[model samples]
Target: MVRAPCCEKMGLKKGPWTPEEDKILISHIQKYGHSNWRALPKQAGLLRCGKSCRLRWINYLRPDIKRGNFTEEEEKTIIKLHEMLGNRWSAIAAKLPGRTDNEIKNVWHTHLKKKIKQKQDSNNQQLYVTVPKCDDLSVIDLSESDNSIIPALPGLIGSPGHSPMSPQPSSSDLSTVTETSGATAETDNIKVEKMDSSDMFFPLLDQDLWSEAELAENSSMELASDSMVAAGFYSNFPRIDDDNDMDFWYNLFVKAGDIEELL
Candidate 1:
């Protein structure tokens, strides 16, 4: 007899598993604990090779595995990680809980690349409208903060303190979030939410970025009956609400030249 490749006949998983294969693979592995992929087939009645079985288990069938398309944030993380790790998919995957290297790599190759292409198209349109080629720079000095125009962000990581805008260590960490304050409201019942890890550039999000006039213009609603601009309301910047949010805002401010410190 062909020995049937270990568990080929022992109800081992073979070929593309049906729903039954999924159930059996999951249940059997969970119960027995797949210590040995080579022997698992014989015992689990699966017909897949040990390597194939291992991949199926780790990449697809793991119970704790997170399944779904990567979010925009996750895409950023993967790009950042790829820049740091440089093709080390397995290492990149380790940092992200429930994420598989294969999945991260797939998203990089398929989705992120396309997104960058689209961003470039948008950038081309915005460049003409936002800044005309008059051979003179704007007073806001957005020269240093225009890097967001680039579609792919991986370069920011691997290049070591190099953004198209700045090579300084602080620029890499800070980016540009220049907001002009206008009118900030005073609400005793203020709300603060922790920012996400996805917010890479923060220190620049504080209301300080906005001028009093700008703040008033951007306010969602009047907080007080008299509508007076609150004292020190926006001044206490770098809210430390979340480092990431600060960074996110900083880049946005710099990109728009609304507050030119990043310039």
Candidate 2:
């Protein structure tokens, strides 16, 4: 069955309702009640459609309809309800006493939407730390000045040539320290022995290991290969596998002032 249009009848009045029309609609509803909105206007002797008369009474001339600006609490309630209910204006209006769905919808478009957008933009903004660039690493100073280098590792402050008050060692000084340190030679011998025995010291950062396209195509195979390389490196230092154990050993070397022992 086809539904008849509400305003299909010809010669029916439309547009803004007059003060007299509002009075008649209010009085008619108060006396006879609006049991049937589709037949209300015809019975009340108004020159408007039943839909028009119904809107006039419910949206405008209802006795309990609240007027004037919405309060701060009401606006907050509308925001919360909108987040949960979305654009169901009628459902949102039911929570706010005497507030119409049309009024709440108008306020959302004109005012609330811009406020929400601004808050989201503020939250999404990224914070960047600016690091000063230096072309000459040899000329860089590490003194206790305003622009002094802050150590990232815990034991770097007490380490040789990396102290805040000491000047950084030159390339010649680094080579001399490497040649004289007995513990450094022992550590190197241990690494060489392991490489000869198991052949586990293959370069994990080789360019041919896995391309970006290959990684995207087969992530599981690439991950397994990467894990095997990582296991080989971790196997060399069984005691320093976790952060706490690593920190303990590093701090011990720093306190003893033996950089060679830390090698």
Candidate 3:
């Protein structure tokens, strides 16, 4: 069997390099220049492999090296890049000005993995509030203004621009998602109106804690009755809205504002 070369035989560092070791490597390189790292280690009086010494100098000890944690946006961009480009750490690192491939890989495995796991967990949560079987299924209550409008929330709106509520993309079909027991019933149409009083803060809501079902049961009356509470919503709730909640139209604006600073 071929034996691996020993540090002593290879004339490389047997342990971690110290300040004294660094000074020696730096002085030798400055005077002789390191055109060939494999030959330089032994000649420079160092016991580290030529490749190891080269990586240390280039990644951390280089004159132009920058060291620090990546910002939140940087992290997100890294995740996007990683998703598109697998474990091409060197390529991902190049996009980042001062980051190294090893560093990016570590963050991808540690931080990115955690965020993806949380996102998956959130997707599993039920956001809607289930109408108990006992509630009169005949006709849910409606106000004088809402009497003419559709009864279901999903029968009214969808992601901005598109019509998730429309019957057949027609103006008349626009207000009737509540017309149930049909050939093609869509996914749960739950509306969750978050009465967030804080302008700058709102934790990530997942399906587990803030499921689509729970959000649908939110009523405007609950929003008007109370706006502030210290408790969480899942423990039966923060406060209740009888009917009619604040318009979630501005919720997108709030979320956009939160990410704007990161850029």
Candidate 4:
């Protein structure tokens, strides 16, 4: 099956877009959002092809797009992914956040590919250096000439017995992990710690306690009314009336400011 050329014979603008064109495309996208690229150019009021508009938005105009040079981590990811999935830039871009496939392709072709080739060539030259032919290969002291050889490809780094990285956790470390897990399980069996008024910093007065306190205070006010208690009387009043009736609200009266702050 044949696919149509992106722009075809349509009189569409090409090459770099102007600032005004960028603004119009951005405004159109912000207002309606991009759903159909084939119909976007007409709606966006641009002479560019749908493909051009899509590329512009995806590579540059998108708000979340990352600009500037590729990071070291990104470079390593690209190289490793290329070794596994060669030239599949879209797949490579999917692994790297905010990077477009087109940008990755350009970077590989323009820079990274050449650098890899040069290194490979240098290693090849070093490995092919002149050495005297000998029937007894064991007699050659290769220990002193180690740096003249090319290092093995880093792709084989983590294989068994070949890696320079730390070995797998020892039996002692595994035992320590088991002990820690056992301690955590034992902790789960412990009873939940109870909180008191001091811990809460607020007196937990139930409805019954609040009503009883209001009634007592009202009775006290009424009794003192006949005798005309002074203005500062309630402020200086002895609140612990009886051990039997002393309740949660009495504590609330003393620490009302703290409770107010909490509220």
Candidate 5:
């Protein structure tokens, strides 16, 4: 069903209300209460529609109507109510005293919407972290080529100003020292060979010397056995004799701790 227009009559005033019209409407409503808004305009002798009169009274002419700028508390209440009630301006106005739905709706569109947007923008800015661009950064070289020796601190164990203790050698320094020591050992062995047995100290025997001597002795024995076999000295000897000899030497080395000590 379609509702009829507020004023179907030929002439009814519209637009901004005049002071004379306001005074008449106020006086009439004060004398006789507006029970029927459609008949109120005719009874009050005002040239306005029923809907126009109702809006004017509710939005402006009411005795309890607040006319000035909205307070901070009222603005906050409107914002909270708007979040809960959404675009229901009448429902939101019910919670605020002396405020009409039209006033609240106007304030929301004109002021509150912009304020909420600005607040949201400020919050979004706070959430983002500013990262420095790659071009702004500098590269640092911490490779061995840059500095071979890292100087000790003043309070540390091997620092120059503190103890007489030296800095620990690097891997390259250790390897160089080992090579120089090995060369000096070879030179000392040559010198020891020229010295007499009575004047010389016992030579330091390593596991490599024992292995080389054992290999040479085994090669000589194999050559002798091949020669004996060719001469037919042991015709009944099995081919497994060489294997038995190898097992015997391996077991002897296992039982005896070192070949150097046995020698």
Candidate 6:
């Protein structure tokens, strides 16, 4: 159902409002207040639609309007508010003094959106390192593979005797998995299938890139998959063994008390 135009059949002026029109609209609004916008133009003696006059008054001609560039703080505020509120420009504008919804929407589209896209593209390119898996499939994303394999490292921590090849906690099982400050449950079910052990060691998540220095100082650490790998820690450690003696290796890498350190 298409609605009728605000002033389609009426010969009311449109486009940019001139100084004479601005003065007339301003004088009328100042004296009587904008109580009835649809009847304002005739009262103000301007041949313009009420919609156009109201938009002009609110967006540009308003006395408290801030007409210059947006400050850094304002830009950050807009971005943060947008993440929570989505494209509700009017609501965002309400938080920002002296900015109109139309102005904020324009800045978002014209400048800020492109800046955010470029930053995301740069991050995606940086995180995407490809490792050669086999002769058939030349390379795959390292981060993608981390989702399936456990990282082999010096400070690794996990539940001993749990096989790396054991399935990850399924979505249904996560509800049963709980965390306490310093307790490890046997039923936690975190496991790793022992690998050839010579394969590359990557951080389980992207954020584990903290320096071994930092890890040494801080005994308790949490791992995130989307984090970057720490510098110099990227080198592969000597493969502990090749035999199927899985329990011995699992114990060395994964101890119940310190498994959280593996991150």
lDDT of each: 0.47, 0.50, 0.48, 0.51, 0.51, 0.52
| Tens-digit lDDT string for candidate 5 (98-202) | 999999999999998787665433422221112222233222221222221111111121122221112323333221111112334222211001112232122
Is candidate 1 or 6 superior in TM-score? 6
- In the range 54-113, model 3's lDDT, one tens digit per residue, is 877767666656578878878877866665566789999889878888888888788876
In model 2, the worst 10-residue window by lDDT is 188-197
lDDT of 6 by residue, 95-194 (tens): 9999999999999899777765554343333222222232242222322444422222222232333323223343333221123334354433233322
Model 3 spans > 4 angstroms off:
1-11, 31-33, 126-263
Model 3 TM-score, all chains together: 0.46
C-alpha-based local distance difference test score of model 3: 0.48
Q: Of the candidates shown, which would achieve the greatest TM-score relative to the real structure?
A: 6
Pairs clashing in candidate 4?
Answer: none
TM-score of each: 0.44, 0.48, 0.46, 0.49, 0.48, 0.51
- Where does candidate 4 stray beyond 4 Å? 1-10, 128-263
- Superposed on all Cα atoms, model 3 deviates from the true structure by an RMSD in Å of 15.6
Model 2 over residues 105-212: C-alpha lDDT tens digits?
Answer: 999899877765554332112100111122221222222322222212232222343311112334333221111123342222110000121222222344333343
Model 1 accuracy (lDDT, Cα): 0.47
Estimate the Cα RMSD of every predicted model relative to the unseen true structure: 17.2, 20.1, 15.6, 31.7, 39.9, 15.5
The runs of at least 3 residues in candidate 5 whose Cα sits more than 4 Å from the true structure, single-residue gaps closed, are 1-4, 128-263
| lDDT (C-alpha) at residue 39 in model 1 | 79
Q: Count clashing residue pairs per candidate.
A: 34, 0, 29, 0, 0, 15
**Candidate order (lDDT):** 6, 5, 4, 2, 3, 1
Q: Ten consecutive residues with minimal summed lDDT in candidate 5? A: 187-196
List candidate 2 segments past 4 Å from native: 1-3, 126-263
